[model samples]
Target: MPDRSLNADTVPAAGPHDVPKAQQAVEERLIDTVLQSFADCEDPRLGQVMQALVRHLHAFVREVRLTEEEWDKAIEFLTEVGHITDDRRQEFILLSDVLGASMQTINVNNEACGDATEATVFGPFFVDDAPRIEQGGDISGGAVGQPCWVEGTVRDTEGSPVPNARIEVWEADEDGFYDLQYTDDRVSGRAHLFSDDEGGFRFWGLTPTPYPIPHDGPVGRMLAATGRSPMRASHLHFMVTAPQLRTLVTHIFVRGDELLESDTVFGVKDSLIKDFVQQPADAPTPDGRELGDRTWARARFDIVLAPA
Candidate 1:
């Protein structure tokens, strides 16, 4: 049986000798009062979670000696974030992404799966029911960016093909804007497709380019105030799913992007970086498709999925 006690480990340590004993006792009692308030929480997991949250939050407040005025400002800032969030934009997710919480959650939940691909942040722009495209079809939908050919094989950890696997992809254009960033509803640079029996898939997309996270929002203002840049590295977002296999939400980054080392969302992993080679107009494509008077880029991303 698990230990149900909230022992010494659950509470913060005593203050230094220079600090007033009365103040420390007051803080400790305040934490105890808060914890007791939720002691009767019906769900054990919810009780544990709430207890931990209160303990950590109170410790943080004491550590920073947080002022009432600052707390009010934080409440106001979060209120503004909620006000700006909608179907097209998710400011809270943007806030979490910038704070590294999103990446940290991904790390904790996704463990090593043999040769299976690594996972990263899902960002704030994934759309459902994306238009399905056929093999070698263009997904850019006339969005502005240099032409790029993306080909990949989806496989299981055992190296067998994952036939009929669903792969959804989305990215920003050369101007660093996702389709939702426009005033009107326009679907660009987004699509979903299935892998063939051989686990092969292909599509035309824009070369991944570095783009700033929507910086006009509250999250962006927070980044600017903290002297941080809102730039995410050049990359393509991918969500892959197959029967009996874990759904993977990740990104493939351009190997030489300047922002790779300093992505605001901290979503980059060494394994997810790949070389996006530029191909001349005369280069032969994998499907023997001909490019006339047009230079393009090519990248192959083989994905391996872990059993669910």
Candidate 2:
């Protein structure tokens, strides 16, 4: 009860010349009222968060003078986003990604430490229980794309080998579709493997290629309205995890990809871009697997993880 009532001096003078100021005082009172409701919240953190959220939301509404019609439209759009979200599709994540919210959260959480590999947005396509592959084995699993040899070592920031680290890798095919996008139960273009005793691992995957995110839903409409493209840069996804180390969800972009500068998710990092060297169709394969006449590519990505 510390003077919850507004002081006359704190409010604008009641006169014809103070219409805007009076309205602002009223709005501020509303914000205070909403904030007070959370005062008795048992959790201090929740109360603090709720109060901040209320303040910001009210400030936004006041700054924009948001119209009822616009608010209604936003509600409608979010409803559509919820309706379209299901097992295979996540329109909410797509919305967050396109707005750079995902990358912003990553940036806030991932601090620069030593030469540790930077983190990026984890696209919604990752699935649990992916097929496992042996070292130097093929993860493509018959996906349609040029073969790519992906080799890498997992090391700590001190450059110590992290043996038996779990690495999950996945990517879309040449046609710009993940295996889950197909109507059938086909599992390809994704797999997991553990680092060797020496922290080395290699596998065959499809060459990274640029692809538009899933964009036939409400999120797509939003993008179209804003004059933005949904294309992500050519890249491959990796999630590396080891004991007592920070788990990393990142991607390696192909150097010189046109979409790198404007990736829809804003997930590209200069440190993550690597060269994918193309080889002749008759070039020898790393594991000596015969690839009739199709050319292949190779890339090496050495990862350094930060302490947990």
Candidate 3:
């Protein structure tokens, strides 16, 4: 009745209505807009996700009355973040870490812990296809720091050994730097090993030190803007997968690592800390090598797998 004669062709698909109905009408319009935005998406799952994203994003924009200037600045930041990504680096992941999105993702996907080891975030620094080495071998390559013997067992939650499990492990060196971050020294300490026939794995490395992640990019700018340091605590990363078992990605943190309470990415949890024990030089290493005149710290922890 209201303007049907003058602007009959200009009516919105949704009508301006009673105050309560107004919101419902707008929501319906938004849903339709989201659906149309992803109409050409190829992946069905991705399409669904993108549609949801659009709906939420639109809602946020409307609720906040986001201004043109602020939105343009947001776009500029995201564009620069993308520009900093490369084959071995991901600035988007860095952004996610600082914003706590990466930790949220880890919690969402790793929902089970039936005697199985708890899972944690896979940080932006993973390297695919690291060098493989034998169990009980020295991975440290004498990088000057506290020596530690890292030994562990792979087992099912039922207490049975999980033989043939693939254990991918890597850690920062003595000065708290990853081999890749400093040099192309592929020959350095970071390496991979597998559980033996008895579901046991072993290696040696210098104690990890707290170090800052590269803050030379857009992510760094964000951290600086927020007064946050780019440092991560000393810890070792492990990913293990076995037959009919769930894959696990987690970190074994140094008990005394100062950044445990303030891990730059908020990735630290008390349950993940492990002690590195100092032992006399005469003690036998897991390798049966005489701990010849070398003081060492020994840490033993096991990973329990969940059945598929």
Candidate 4:
């Protein structure tokens, strides 16, 4: 209170105790000044986040002796990332993916995977509320490469079946491209389904294939600059929710997908991979198409949920 405005700019003269005192004084003042900037924020969460962000940003600038040129380049990169975002795509999520921030967040929040199935990253390609189908149904309604049959049980951590559970599933075709990626006329490989009284559901779809994520944007360029691949491993996406249960969103990777070791988004987990093999032509399918003649991959994976 003693003329802080006047004293703030005046550094103590160099002396035996002067350096330490000056350093402490500067630290205290910097913290106060930074926090004061956020004191006007109405939301407590926003204020806390802004203050922490500023503290870390300033600390980084000081610690690295950050160059103005480097800062400008960073600003440019961030602006590009923001500018490329829209309803179907989010560059920030892509940024988080490349930096491994998204996986770290998932790890921190989903640390309780003792016996329940392990959780994995949620990719950005999902469209909420797919059309609902029934057990033993097929989600893939478009051009399928290899017919795949996926049947699974929905159960809680205690091994109890979750009745009437809603299971949302989607995946890329054998070509590593989603339905949305193709022309507007295709719809063979997109559908949704629900569980039964015994918490069982089944679906048929095409075998997923290793494919590249969208690489025409800045994230793609960044990956190229870093010499990293832009391919996501073959996998099936599922989101399950029911009353009194923890909602789960995850992927069931196809074993031996080429990109399993190097998924562009780092979403692959060894535990998430399952056997998706080909069946003979004698197998009964809703389409009644000969199986091996066209090469099909069959997979059955059960999801173990956490109690609410």
Reference-based TM-score of each model: 0.92, 0.93, 0.83, 0.83
lDDT of 2 by residue, 1-308 (tens): 33434455444333222225567778779998999999999999999999999988886776667789999999999999999999988889989999899999999898999999999999889999899988997888889999999998999999999999999999999999999889898999999999998899999999999999988989998888999998999999999999999999999999999999999999999999999999998999988989999999999999999999
After TM-score superposition, the amount by which residue 276's alpha carbon in candidate 1 deviates from its true location, in angstroms, is 0.4
Clashes of 2: 0
**Model 3 lDDT per residue over 82-139, tens place:** 8889766788988898788898888888877677888888877777767787987767
Runs off by more than 4 Å, candidate 3: 1-32, 39-44, 141-144, 280-294
Candidate 4 C-alpha lDDT tens digits along 1-308: 23323254455432222224466577668878988989999999999999998888776665565679999988999999899887767788878987788888877777675466667777666777577777766687756577788888989988889888888788777776777666564655667777888988877777787888778888899899999988888887888889887778788988876778888787877779998876666666645655545555677888888776
Quantify all predictions' global Cα lDDT against the true fold.
Answer: 0.91, 0.91, 0.79, 0.76
Which ranking of candidates, highest lDDT first?
1, 2, 3, 4
Please estimate how well model 3 matches the true structure, expressed as its whole-model Cα lDDT: 0.79
Judged by whole-model lDDT over C-alpha atoms, candidate 1 comes out at 0.91
Question: Which residue ranges in model 2 land beyond 4 Å of their true spot?
Answer: 1-19
Evaluation by lDDT, superior candidate among 3 and 4: 3
Model 4, residue pairs in steric clash: 133-192, 140-188, 140-189, 141-187, 141-188, 141-189, 142-188, 142-189
- Backbone clashes under 3 angstroms, per model: 0, 0, 1, 8
Angstrom error at residue 252, model 2: 0.4
